[model samples]
Target: MKKICLTIIMGLVIVFLNGCEKVLEKTPDGQTTIDKVLNDFARSKGLIDAAYNEVYQARDQIAFVFSPLESLTDNAFWAATYNPYRWHNGSLSLSDPVITWDWSSPNDQLWSDFWRGIRLANNAIKYLPQSTVITEEQRAEWIAEARVLRCWYYMQLLEFYGPMPWIEEPIEPNYAGWNELVRPGYDEIVTRLESELLDVINANIFKPRVGAVDAKRVTNGIAYAIRARLLLYNASPLNNPENDRTKWQRAADAAQDVIDLPSYRLVPMSEYKRLFIGANTTPVDEIIWRAWTDNSHINNTNGVDVGSYPFASISHMWNCGESPSQELVDAFEMTNGALPVTYNDATHTTVTVTPEAAALGYSEATGGDPYSNRDARFYINIVHNMYNYGVPYNCTEPYIIETFVGGRNGFNDVISQETQRSCPGYYSGKDKQVKYWGPGNSGEGNEPTHWVLFRLAEFYLQKAEALCELGDPDAAATALNVIRERALQPRIQDVPGFANTQEFLRERIRNERRVEYCLEGQYRFIDQRRWKILNETNRFITGMRITKGGNGQFSYQRKKIRDYQSYTDKYLVMPIPLEDAKKMTSMLQPKAWQ
Candidate 1:
C-alpha cells in the first residue's frame, strides 16, 4: 500500500494559481485516475491551489510579483549585469540570456515561466468543469479563478513579447504544427482576453474580498482592476496604433468600475506606507490585488533593503544597489506648487534650492538637504540627502540619510567605493523597510516585502490619463486631484500660473504617474512606451553631484552618470524569446528587433 501511494503521488503534478506548492494525499490504491481525482472536491481544489501558487513561481520559489524588471526603467539603476541593467543600458539583444532560455538556470527563462503558468491554468480550466464530485457552483467559481490567471499570464506575455499565440485549450505534446504556430496580432489578442475577462466578471463567480483566507484568491475587485489595467494597456499608443479615443473612453470606464467598488479606497496618507512595507495581518484597503503570503509580513529577503536602502540607514547586511536617478528626483514638485528645483550656480548657492525654497520650510541656504519641502509623496518614496530612514532596528529615532558626495552614504564614500554613482538616493519607507532584525540578520534580504500590484491610487491616475488623452483636461484634473489630495500636495489647478491646456495637463499627468508609481513595478516604463516618449524624455539619464563649498554649504551639480545609455525605439517592446522564435518559423519578432 505504501509503495502504491508513493508511486501515485510521485506521478501526480498539480499546478496552483499562486504558483506555490503544497503536499497532497497519496492515492489509497494504484488505481488513481484523472477522472477519480477530478471527482473529489478536495483533490480538484488541490489542483486549483497549485495553479494559484504557480502564478508567482519564478524558478523553484515564489518571487515578488514586481520583478526586478522595475530597475530596468528610468526610475532605478541596479549596477549589476542582470537583464534589468542590460535592458536599461540598451545592451540587450534577441540572443540575450534573458530573452533566450538558459536551460540550466530556471529563473532566467521569463518566457517559459509565464508560459508554464498559462498551461497550468488552462489545464485546471479544462478539467474543473468535468469534475463530478463538485457541484456546478464550485466548478463555476474554480473555473473563473483559473481563467483570471490565464488572462493575467497572457497579459504578461503580450506586454513584453507583443502578440503571443492565443491558447484557449490545453495543447498536447504530440499536437501537430506546434513549432510553426504564429502569434496573433495585438487586436485579436486584446479582444480575446477582454472577452474572457468579461465572461468571468459577469459570471458572479468570485467572492467580495476580505482578509487572509480570501486574500490571495481572485475576487470581484481584482478582476475589475485587471480589466481596467488591460483596457489602459490596449489604449496605449504602442498597442493602439490608430490612436483611438474610444479605447481611452473604455479604459476610463473600466477604471471607474474599480473606483466604484465599495471595498477599494486609498488608505489614508498616515496608513499609506503600511500598504507596501509593514507586517499586516489583514489586507489593506488600498490594495485591490496582491500576491498573498501566509506569513504575516511580505519577505524582502532579496536584499531589497541592502539594494534600495542607503548605507547610512545602519543596515545589518550589504547595502546599496538600485539607486534612483536624479532625473526621477527632479520629477518631484515643490510643496508650493512650483516646478522641480533646478541648478543655478549664480543666483542660488546650491543646486538644490528652488525659487520656492522659503515656502518649503527649509532654513538652510547652503542646501545640504536637497529634498526639503517637496511633494509629500517624495518623503514616502525617495531617499535623498538628509532625509530620515525611519526608526532604526535598535529603536532609535529615524536616521537622517546622507547621500551627498562625502556624506556617510555618498557615492564617493569609502563604504560605497565599489560603485560611485550619484546620491539623490532612493529609500523605501518604514512600511516597506524592515524595522526589526530577523533571525541572525540573515533575514535582511528575506525581510517581509509585499508587492501592491494594484491600488486605488493607480486607478485615480489611470482615469486622469485616459481623460487627458480623450481631450478633457478639466475632467482629467478632477480625477488627478483625488490622488493629489491623498498625497497632501497642491492640486492640479492650485499650481499658480500653470496653464490647463491639454498639452500642459498631459505633461502633469505623465509626471504625476512617474513620481506616484516610481519603482513599484514597470509603471514608468509602460507609460513612456505607451506615449512613445522614451526617445524624447529619456534621451540621457542624469545623476547629481554634491561638492562642499568654501563656506561649508553643499553645492550640487546634475551630471550624466557614466556607462549609462538611454534606450532607443527598439526598447519600447522586448523581442520574443529567441528559443521560442527559432522554433516557430512564422513567429514574428518585434519590429524593432528585426
Candidate 2:
C-alpha cells in the first residue's frame, strides 16, 4: 500500500512540473545578453512594438498635460464655469510643473517618458548593425522609422520644456554620469531634428499602407507631418530669435510635401463627426498620423471613458470634465463670411425665459434660429441642446433644427457630478463617442476609435499660417481656401481684412487655427505663449455666488468685470520638480520659482 501511494504522488508531481514548464516557456530569459536579446526576432519586434506602446501611453496622458494649459487660456473651454485649481491657485504642480506650476524640476515623467522613446529609437538604430537577417535596404528603412519617432519625442519635449538635453545614444550607466550632461539650445535641437528628418524623407522608409493603425509605429507621412509641425513651431515667436522668414518657408514646404502625397486625403464632410466617435472602418483624409488602439491594446478599456461625458444616460447626460467655453463657440463664423448673430447685441431683442429653458439652464433666449446660417463645421463639431436626445436635424449652410431643448426660458445645467452640477454649459463634441451609453447612464466605454496625432488638415492650416507670417498673403489665402473649400464654408474674397499684407493674414491665420483646431486641444496656452499674449489674456475669477431656490432652481452670480493678474516668470516655463532637482546637481530651476 505504501509503494502504491508513492507511485501516485510521483505521477502528480510530474503533471504539476509539466504544467509549470508550459507557463514559464515564453518568459524572457534574463541570462540572455543585450546583443542576443536584440537579435532575437521576437525580442527585436517587441522592442520595436514598444515604440508604438509609448504612443498610446503618451496619448492617455496628453489630456492631463493639455487640459490645464488649454483651460488657462481661452480656446474651446470657458474659464469661469470650471474650477480654477491650475489657473488661480497654481496647483498644476501636483501633475506637472514643467509647463504650468513651477514646483517640480524638469526631470519628471514628461522628460523621462520622452527620453524613454528616444532610447528605444536609439536601441533600434544601434541594433540594426547587428541584425544580419534584415537587409541593408530594410535596415535603412527601420532606422529611418526609428529616427522619425525619436524626432517626434524630441519635438514634444522641445514644445513643453524648451531646450532639453539631447540624447541619441542608448542609456549606459557604466559609460557616463549625469554630471556630464547639459541642455542643448532650442535652435540646435531644431537643426538636429531637421537633419534627421531629411534622412527619413530621402530614404523613402515607412509602412506603405494608407489606413494601417499602429500607435507606436511611424510612417513616412508621419515623419513629414512631424517635420511640418516642428518647423511651424520653430518659426513661432517663442523659438525664432531672428524672426526668420526662411523658417516659415521651410514649414510651408514640409506641409505641402505631405499634402502632395496621394495616400493622404480628408474624410468626407458627412462622416466628420463619426470619424472621432469610435472605431471607424472608413479611412479619414484628415488624419495624417494616429496612435492606433484596439480592444487588446493597453489603456484600451479606458479609451471611451477618457473621451466621453461622465453621465448615466445619453439623454440626460452632463459633460464630465471637458466643457466648451462660450468664447470658442462664438469663434465659429457664419456660413456667409460673417460672425454669428448670437454675438450681436440686437439678438437680445427678445427676452422671454421659459420654465423648461430655465430648468435646462441657458441664459440665451430660446426659439431663435441658433443653428440657422452657421458654419457647417460648427454643426459637425459641437453638440448643443438642439442636437441631444432624439432630435432630428439636417445640418448644412442653412441648418434646420427640428428639436431644440432648453428653450429660451428653461436653463439646463450640464456640468457633471464631479463639479456638483454647479457649472452649466454645452460640452465639446470633439472626442466623445456620440452613440455611447452606459448602464449607469455614463458616457464611458471602450471606444474603438483611434486618436489622431497628426493630420493633413492641420498641415494645411500650418502652411497657411507660415505663409502669412512670411509675407505671402496670396499663398496663405490659397492654403486657407483649400481647407475652407473642403469644409464647404463660403470662401472670403481676401481672407477678411487681410487683403494683401502678411500682418493681416497672420491675424486671420491665428483666428483660423482657433476655429479649425478648436477642442482638438491645440490653441490654449500655447497660442497665448506663441502670441506673447499670456500676460495680457484674462486669468482670474472675481467671485462665484450660488443662489438656490425652493423650486429646485439654482442661479450662479458673478462680478461683471474683474482684474486679471499673470503669474511670475517662473510660471512661464514650468518649474523643475523639487525632488528631481535634488537628484540632478546640474539642473537649474526656472528663475523666480522657489
Candidate 3:
C-alpha cells in the first residue's frame, strides 16, 4: 500500500504554490504517507497550491521566459540574444527549451507545463472532495480554488496556442492513448469555458477572495478578470473575423461583472505605482491578483540588475534584460492631452506635433529637452534622457540617469555591447522598481516589492474595448475616461477635435492599453496579435541617438534600432512543438503555422 501511494504521489506530479513556505517546517519527508496528504487539511491544500505554481509569469521569469514577454512586442527591447529574440531572429524551432519545456532545464513551455497543472488540478478536484478530515466548507473553498486555477491555465493556453483539447477530469492510468488527444475547435473551447468554468466561478463558489495576506494567490477576482480578458480576445478581429456583436456583448458584460465585485476599487492616483512596489504592503486597492514568492519581489526586477542591464545603477542582475522602446516612449501623450508626435504611418516618418500640443509649446523634435511636459504617467513609466531615476535597492533616494553616448547610463549602436549601454535611448522607469543596488546606493533605506497580475484598471479597458466593438463608443468613452482620470489626463470626450466614431475610439482604447499597461505583462504582445495589427506594430523598434555638444547640451535623433525580419504570420500563435504534436495524430497547428 505504501508503494502504491508513493506511485500516486509521484505520478500526479503535485508541487506547492507561493505560500507553501509557511506550510513546511523543514525539508519535506519524502517518505510521508499518502493517507496524511488525503486526510490532513494542510497537505491536501498543498496539492491545490501545486496548480498555482505551474502557471508561469508572463511579465518576467528571467531564466524561464528569457526576458519578459515584452521583448517580443514593441513595448521594449531585450538587448541580449535570449529566447524571445530567437523567435523574431528566425532561430526558433520545436527543439527550443521554451517550446519543449524541458523538465531537466526547468523550462516554461506553454504546452507541457499547463497540462501538468491541469493534471495536478484534476488530482486535487478528484481527491479534495473525498477528504474525510476537513469540513465541508473547507473542502468547497479549496476545491473551488483548484477548479478556477485549472480554467485559468486553460485560458492562458488558449491565448498563446489558440484552441486546445478540453479535459474535465483526471485521466485513468490506462486511459486512451496520446493519439486520442487531438485539438478542438475555437468555439468549442470558448463555450466550454463559459458554461462550465467561468459560469461556476462567477457564481462565487470560492471565498470572497484569497485576501491581503496571500495577495499573490489566485482569487475569485482573478477568475472573473481572466474570463473577461478571454472573452475580449475572443471578440477581437483576429478571432471574430465575422465581427460578431454577440461576442463583443459577452465580453462587455463579463468585464462589467468584474467592476461589480465589491471588494476591489482602483487605488487613487497617489497609490498607482505603489501597486508594483509593495509600498503599502497591504492589499493594493486596484490589484486583483499578483505573482509572489519569498525571495524575489516584482520591484522592477526587469531592469533591477545593475550588473549587465544599462541604466539601473542599483540592482544585482546577471543578464542585460528588457528596456523600453522609443516607439513606446512616443505613446505617452503630452501634459495637454495630445500626442507629441502625430505619425502618418507605422514607418514613423511623416510626423508632426498635434496643433493642440504644439500650441502648448511642446516639441518632441530632434533635440532640446523633449522629455519634459509629457503625460503624468510618462514620468512614472520611463527614464528618458535627462530624467531622474529613483530608489536603488541599496539606497533610499533617487539618482539622475543620463542616456547620452558617454553618459552615466550610456546609449549606443553596437549590438554586442547592448547590455553595456542601453539599446533603446530610454529605459522604463516603471519597470525598474529600483535603479541598481551597489553602483548608486545612497545607503539610507529599503523598499518593498510585489507583482500585480489582475487589477481593476484592465477590466475598465476591456469594457471600453468591448463597448467600442459593439458600436457604443459613448459608453466606451465612460470606461476609458475612468483610466484617464486616474492618470490625470483629460477624458476622451474633452480631447480637441475628438470624434466618437468606432474607428477613432478604438485607437484611443488600444493606445490606452499600450501606455497604461506597458511593462506590466505580455498584454501588448498579445493585444497586437488579437487585433491582427502585429505586422504594423512589430516591425521596427526605434531608438533615439543622443549626442552631447561642446556646450554640454544633448541633441536627440530618432533612429530605427533593428528591422524585425521575422514578424510574419506564424507569430499569430506559437506553433505546437513538433514532438509534442506528433503524439496526437490529428492535432492541427495554428492556421498561420500550418
Candidate 4:
C-alpha cells in the first residue's frame, strides 16, 4: 500500500512540471509561434506588419496622440472631459490611474500602449535572428527596422513623461517586479535612445523612402528626423542646464542629414492643403512618415478631429472641442510677409492698421477683417467668420461660415436654438468642399486627415532654429526662406521691418513653427516649454467672441477664454503617473512633482 501511494504522488509531480513548462512557452497569445513565423518569409513579413498595425489601431489615435494635447498650448482649446483635458487643465494628480505607477495590467492608456509596442518590437527583433528562410542581410535590415520602431515608441513616451523605465530586453509576464521597475535618469534614457538610433543608421538598413506597399514604414529619413528632433529637445532649456552649444550643433547636423537626402522636397503651394485631406493613395512627397489608413479604416464617424470644425457646423452627436485661439490666428504673417496683425494690447481685438494688412483689403479702424490678407496657409488651416470658401466641386453654391452672434452656426445662437436648422453652412454634400466636412443625414462627416509625423519643411525650420541659437542668424534666415518662399510669402530677409538680431530670429522661428505646425501635434506646447516661454505664450488661452448685427456686420473681441496661470517650470516635464510612483517607492518623481 505505501509503495502504491508513492508512485501516484511521483506521477502527479511530473504532470505538474510539464504544465508549468507549457505555461512558459514563448508563443504570444493569438499569434503564431516564433518557429513558425521564422520558417517562412511571408510569416515574417506578417509579423512586421502586425507591429505597424498596432500603431495605427488605436480607436482615437489622432485625438489620443495629438489633438486633445493641443489644449495644453495656446494653439487650441479642449472642453471634453477626456484624459487629455484633465492633463491640459492640470487636474491630473499622482494618483491618476492612466499615468500612475501601477503597471500590472496592460490597459489601452498611452503609457501601456507604448510599453506594449516596445515589447512587440523586442519580440520581433529576437525572432528575426532565428529565421533560416531569409538572407542574413534581410535579417539584419528587419532587425534594424524593429529597433527603429522601438525607438519611436520611446520618443513618444519621452515627450509626455520625461524619463521612463527603459526596457532593453523583453520582460516575461511572470518576471517579478516587472510592474514596479524603476526608471533611469533623463540623461541615461537619452543616451540609450541615441545609441540605438545611431546603430540602425550606421547599418544602412532603412531607406530614405519606401514603396507604396510600405507607405508609412520607418525609413532612413524618418529615423534621422527623429534623431534631430530628439537632439534639439535635449539641447533646449528643458534638458540642457548649461545651454550646451555642442548639443545644438549635433541637432543641426542631424537635420542636415535629412536635408541632404535627395528623395524629398516641398510640394507646390497649390497642393499643400491636399497633402493632409486628399485621398489615401494620393502621392505627396512632403509626408516623411504618417500613420497611413485607408477608407476601410478611415474616420467614417465624426470623431477624428471634430474639434477642428466650428461649433455651429457639426451635428448634435459631436461637440466643438478644438477651436483655434486668437493667439494662433494672429501668428500668421501678412500676404506680403509682413509682421502679424499688430494689436494695441494683449486683447488682440483692436488691430493697429499696417500697410501690409490694408494692402490686402483690411480696415485698421474697425479691426478690419482679421482673416483677410494673411498667408496662404492661414486660409487652408483656419476658418474664420464670414470667409467664403469657393463653391464645392460637387455643389454649385459657395459655403460661407457664419460664426457671428445670432448668425447660423454661431456658438451662442446654436445653444439657444434646439433645432439645428439655425445652422446653415451646408445641409448636405460637404465632401466637395476642401476645408470642412459637415454632418449630413447620416449624422456623420468624413475628413481623411493624415497626422503628419515629420516633413521636409519642419527640418528646415529645425535647422533655422539651431542656427539662430548658434548666432548664425544670416544662415538661419536663409533656411527660414525655404519655407517662406514655398508658401509664396516674401523671404524673411526681404520683410520690411524685420531685424537681423538673434532676438528677432528667435521670435521668427517660434512664430514659424506655431503657424506651420498648428493643430498637427504637440509641437506648439513642446516648443514653448523648450524655449521657456510658457508664462508669456501659454498662460492665458484666448478665443474670439463674434457678434453679428441685424445688418450682417460682424463684430469681434479677443476674450481670455481660460486662465492657465498655474503653469510653471515643473509643467515643462510632466510628472510620472501616480500608480507607477506608488509601486516604486524608492523612485523619485520628476523634480517639483513631489
Top TM-score hit? 3
The C-alpha lDDT values of all candidates are: 0.64, 0.52, 0.69, 0.62
Candidate 2, residues 516-568, lDDT tens digits: the string is 77665444556666556555444532222234346634443322122234443
TM-score of 3: 0.88
> Which of 3 and 4 is the better model by TM-score?
3
Q: How many backbone overlaps does candidate 2 show?
A: 38
Displacement of residue 522 (Cα, Å) in model 3 is 1.6
State which candidate, 1 or 4, has the greater lDDT.
1
In model 3, the clashing pairs are: 300-433, 305-317, 306-315, 313-436, 314-435, 314-436, 314-437, 315-436, 315-437
Best by lDDT: 3
Summed over model 3, clashes come to 9
**Which runs in model 4 stand beyond 4 Å of their true positions?**
1-37, 40-43, 54-67, 83-85, 97-108, 133-137, 173-187, 207-211, 294-317, 342-361, 364-367, 390-394, 413-447
Each model's TM-score? 0.84, 0.74, 0.88, 0.82
| Each candidate's clash count | 33, 38, 9, 13
